[model samples]
Target chain A: MSVLTQIKQAPAANPIERLLLATEADMAKVNALILSRADSHVEMVPELARYLIESGGKRLRPMLTVAAAQLFANGTGTAVNFAAAVEFMHNATLLHDDVVDESDMRRGKPAARMVWGNKASILVGDFLLGQAFMMMVETGNIGALGVLSSASAVMAEGEVFQLAKTGDLTTTAADYAEVIRAKTAVLFQAACEVGAMSGGADDAGRKALAQYGLELGNAFQLVDDVLDYGGQSGTLGKNVGDDLREGKMTLPVILALAEASSEDRETITAALGDAEATADQVAAVVAIMERHNTLARTMEQAQAHARSAKAALEALPGSEMRSLLSEVVEFSVVRAY
Target chain B: MSVLTQIKQAPAANPIERLLLATEADMAKVNALILSRADSHVEMVPELARYLIESGGKRLRPMLTVAAAQLFANGTGTAVNFAAAVEFMHNATLLHDDVVDESDMRRGKPAARMVWGNKASILVGDFLLGQAFMMMVETGNIGALGVLSSASAVMAEGEVFQLAKTGDLTTTAADYAEVIRAKTAVLFQAACEVGAMSGGADDAGRKALAQYGLELGNAFQLVDDVLDYGGQSGTLGKNVGDDLREGKMTLPVILALAEASSEDRETITAALGDAEATADQVAAVVAIMERHNTLARTMEQAQAHARSAKAALEALPGSEMRSLLSEVVEFSVVRAY
Candidate 1:
């Protein structure tokens, strides 16, 4: 049987995992490029950089870039470069985020900052970002470069906005939407947009990919945020209620706060930003979210984004890659189930 | 008298100050661009960014970019954008550096971290860097973008290397050279090279400007290092002996360590990395540096680089700007006197 026929017959495998298998060949090249680019004559740079990059998170962002590129067969090998650049940008942000959040663990391992110290993390993060831009410049595509650079600026702005809103009960759901869009969705939009551009996709294909990626990124983050309060630590690779402890105003909390009674609101506000909050406090906060049906509503919101993500794919001609990307968005939101 | 003759006849005006005056009209546009680009809907970003960018330092790096571009009369107006980008890059580094060093003062003011906090400083620094790259992308000069991006990587590497060498008495002079070159000289080289490119410089003119900027940057940093030990706190915009307390292995310190008696070596090492080192300890270290004439040797080294910087100008056709650039190199080192 042909590979497509066999893929169709594969009944039980998750779409994301299947998509990963489908794009594994191109992704290997991106992975190799990432490893080579992360290297430096300075020993600590590569050492600290690999410590985070090699950590076994799903390489979802780069995979999206690769998969989006593969939606068209006109690849000129620029997608490999863009995929690697996207990964570098993501890793750089992780390094800085750990320092900013004082995170002790990532991907079920000691965070890079925890191992290398905050100073090394900060400088090495800068190094990775510089390398990301270098790879983008090598592509000689000015339009793609403009897209990526704007995403970069918006991501920083999103991060700053999130920092500004931390622990503020007055933060609106609109503000939360803006935060997730800036912090997470913008890069997704840029990645898929540039991927399609590299794949020789015309304007319609690129716009479709961009909209699809943005909605998928929104769904991905909302599910991840819900998981922070409800998923297992082993599955999440982080402690439960980390967002609450860090005072991150995620959607479920925002929704819960808006609907909760004064007593329940007091329960959350007390635990918010309190690093010393006990397990019982976290349980109480989760219970309030449950009482308000916020987690379920958050999952519904994520599902809505996932549906939009799939809807955006209508702009592109039907292909197995496109169908698989559509299913991946469903799989992302369904995880909260 | 003509403007060139008038400039030559001007009595004892600092060449850097004179260059700034010469480029005032163009630089005003660059300054305005910097302010406008730094703005954001996220208010803290613009606030913290301006707090650093508007802080009155020499604006020396941007001035070099503008003057180098002015060497060719065929300016395309891109130099204004490049100049602003260079300033943003410089200011971004300063924000992150202050956080990494836990510094208390910058430009004779409390460091941004002290006023705004490290998290804000870090995120705002990222914002400025993003803005810097955006401005570069707007220029649509991929080659110049490559130059700036590579310099950014090298600067981060230099900072990491410096961190590695901190308090290591065994650090060689070659290592010190590598650190300062990466940290300081590369940006200067890139600034002038891109400026010349924007100004429509020929290959020889670009190469000459790059060499001149590199050597002048070497001389400038050497003088700055010497001043850290010998200049007043009011003049240096930082406490005297701050480098010693931080255990920086600068040129004079390296030289002094090499030639000191064992007793004097003990005094220097004891004070190294001792954040609370007494004024008497700093004086003793300086006294040893004087006994070994290390400060004088460092000044001699600066003078040598300054001369090489001037010699590099021989490749370019002589113009008032070229003459003023050569004089700026001399004036950089003369500050030591």
Candidate 2:
């Protein structure tokens, strides 16, 4: 099944049906806009740019943008533009982030940086960022532009914060949350909020959507952290222990190390410090997480965020879109891939 | 004398006057604003955040930003914000550029990456970028945001273009122009255009200012390139032949290499390829430039650009500011430091 198809089928069994339904209700439209928006920039090299745009990533962020707009604009069509804008923002960040991380592989494919070289990757990422703001300007939405630029600023700040915290085991959950919000969730939140602002949702509706995205983003990242530890490498489309190899201090590892005996903590810390940590050593670190149930404990926190995200949706008047949003919350908890 | 004091005292004696007046008229207010925009979020270490901002360096880009605004605005005060915005953009690039270059020095001080580590530098750069956009957004001027974002995209593109062309002697003046325009001139253009837009200049006026800035920026970079080779080391405040050591394919070297014998070209290219070109080899390369009159040839091109920049300014109504700008063109061509 296609990614969207799998999402559609799983909604009935999901606890957070509203989340998925809201996202699903907008997915077809959001995906269509994303696929077509490239037509807007014929001046750029399509051959080079298409690989990234057509890459079969889920359109969650864009959907949130559109969904937010829909909520605020009294169900207007501005959501389509919001969706495209958010995706551009996400893709821009992804392209640059790959370079910063020196990451070679992403979503089971060679990353843009690896395929195109850092020069191409960095420039293209920049092109997309400019294009994003251009779209926002075209929308003639001052509030939307404010939210996006602010969110982007937060996102970069958070990424830098994470960069600062790298390989440091003293990192706390609060610290992790601040970085995660900036790095991942702020865009997601902005995506939804911009969507709402476009839809002319009253201030209150905009706030609700913003809260929902923030919580959902937190849940999404927590699950991402869990998958880094225990998910099947093939299924996750990430190398086993890629996070450990990268020396990224994610919540599972941070929490696991914090709770470990001194000897085990020393081992984890030493592995983090060494640039050349072996796969066996990474596996050993994973074993420590399992022993501490850090992944499971983190999973529970993810569940709490999912619940908060779902509850935020309760403020929205019921619609097919609202139901889909609820499903997104459950999908956040149980998705294996 | 302190840099600021020296800048203030030399108001019309060529370089000092243009630099100091520009700093006073454009950067003073903007620098104050730029200094105040840091995030005070409990999680962010403000001390670390302020490292680059507090580090004393000439606010040249910000001055350019303000000058552009002043010319466009023509007695309006809106240029101050644009000035700050442009400087923010310049500093953001510097933060990233430092990391990419892996250099450990700036203005005879530890580079942001050197003092704070690459992660901090990178993150702070991201923060500055965010702050730049935020400042633009506050203008409530979509056009301003568009100009700033477009300039940003161009800057990154130029960086990549330069990166791709490095050490490739086959690169032409046209290719070099494209790289320099992207890397440097566009921001100068944007700085001017954004000022015009804020100052309510007609499209013609805005276009004129942008063209002037672009030409001036080209001249500015050419002079910088020349200074790297031609200026006294201490006065230039940069290591002599620093660009040569860095393998930067600046205009003088490119021009010189173009005229060199096959053996000379090979020797220069090989020296460039080595990560550590000796000081004696650098001096030998300089000797070749003196022999071939490449420095004079390069200066002629810079002078031509300075002339074109002056011609562009003729479109603007003559005023004290206009005369100051005219003086800057002459200053750019003649300044030894």
* Model 1 chain B lDDT-worst window of ten: B1-10
Top candidate when judged by TM-score against the true structure: 1
TM-score of each: 0.97, 0.88
User: At residue A116, what lDDT does model 2 achieve?
Assistant: 70
Computed on C-alphas against the true complex, the DockQ of each candidate is 0.82, 0.39
The CAPRI quality class of candidate 1 comes to high
TM-score quality measure for candidate 2: 0.88
Q: Output the number of the DockQ-best candidate.
A: 1
Residues A35-146 of candidate 2 have per-residue lDDT tens digits of 6554422233343456777776766787667656655436646667777778877887787777777777777788877777654665566666666776777777888888
Reference-based lDDT, residue A289, model 2: 86
Query: What TM-score between 0 and 1 does chain B of candidate 1 receive?
Result: 0.97
After aligning candidate 1 to the native by TM-score, how far in Å is the CA of B11 from where it should be? 5.0
